[model samples]
Target chain A: MRIGDLAARTGVSVRSLRYYEEQGLLDSSRSPGGHRHYDEEGVDRVAYLQRLYAAGLSSQTILSLLPCLESPSAATSDSAFDRLVEERDKLVTHIAGLTRTLESLDELITLNRKRRAASVADPDSGEPGRTTQG
Target chain B: MRIGDLAARTGVSVRSLRYYEEQGLLDSSRSPGGHRHYDEEGVDRVAYLQRLYAAGLSSQTILSLLPCLESPSAATSDSAFDRLVEERDKLVTHIAGLTRTLESLDELITLNRKRRAASVADPDSGEPGRTTQG
Candidate 1:
């Protein structure tokens, strides 16, 4: 398909598609007229890349892993699969850490808002020089 | 304090501190000896910036929000606080979405691993030619 059609089908901007290609996350062959052409499998590839990215994997990591999915030799090798499992486990742990930190940030934001509201309501009660003094 | 002390105290690398300064997330004044000097409050500021970055906020967003914490006018203004609250809410939503996606990817990886393991164990049973197949 052409770039415009691929962008519309994937719901990704053409610029991002180009960027992904530049990052080696996507590929397109040139036609006889020098225009880009992508096969139907490109859609699935793009979707997989998007999923990896959303999971906080870097473009470089995704590019490296793409070969494991594409090459039958690597896909069928027990050791390769084992390595993939280990990498995925690390990714899960990393995501868990990020999730915990995100929750803490949410709590901090909530507390900050509450403190600000209280300070606004009671100018002289909480923390001298912090109410009308700051 | 100098950059090295600040890095030692914060547990951040000196290179990252310099990068943060280049990204406008940190500031340092020069001493008479041509060395960078930071006030005590710089520690808290760096910590805050780290927290924001860990929360998945971009350096640019953190830099923009830094002024709110530093300037009494913006910090105390109800409108500015409201904007901050809104931005924080958006950030929370974004983090939640990413967390959900991460969880889904974890499940997908688990399923893939299980399928691969079963295929490896039974070379002739599952899915014609898929056992010993690619």
Candidate 2:
């Protein structure tokens, strides 16, 4: 398949796939016309890279951890082990912060939604203050 | 409290606090000596801003959502409601991806730790291959 196809399947941008290729995180071959081509494995690899990037992992960190990710049961490099654990801890803290943010946003959203619902149900009072809140 | 004190209390930079003030997300008063001052409310406001930033909310998006955040029972603007829901959905998807990444990193870390532990227990074979696997 083509690079664009892989990007479509993974829901990642073509530019990002190219960036991953540049970072040595993704593999692609050249077609007869010199366009990039990928296989099914490339799709899974791009998805994995996307997750790591989503966790705010630097390309360098992902590179360090790739060995262990690829061969999980094999003897792993010390650097990879250390990076993995460090990233995991950082991610835990980040997730906690984001969860709190989500909760706060949820509260605000719920409050607004409830207000809209209540006002919409009271047509007499709502008619005067109508303003596309729903 | 002084701006520096607020920074210290909130674990945020004076520059960031000033930016938040500029964005109207935070409030501060200038003293006779031309120093910015804040109260306990500043601390909480900074914390809230930090959480929103952590969840990848832009200053503009936060500005749009601030009305309901400040006065939960007040009628929310339509723009605020829309932006809040949009940002909430984005954060939800982002958190899911990061959680998956964290789990993957955990698996890799555990695999490497097990390999190291196993190699160390078999020191007769490990001594010859010892190279900081732990």
lDDT of each: 0.64, 0.75
Tell me what TM-score chain A of model 2 achieves: 0.74
| CAPRI-style grade of the A/B interface in model 1 | acceptable
Q: What does DockQ come to for candidate 2?
A: 0.33
Worst 10 residues of 1 chain B by lDDT: B125-134
Number of clashes in every candidate structure?
0, 0
Residue-by-residue lDDT tens digits, candidate 2, A69-115: 76653366677767778878999999998988788778667766777
Error of 1 at A48 (Å): 3.2
The TM-score of predicted model 1 comes to 0.68
lDDT of 2: 0.75
Give all TM-scores, in the order shown. 0.68, 0.81
Put down candidate 2 lDDT per residue, B1-134, tens digits, no spaces: 99989999989988998899899888878899888888787777788888888888789888887766775433566776777788899999999988877776776676666767777776433322222111
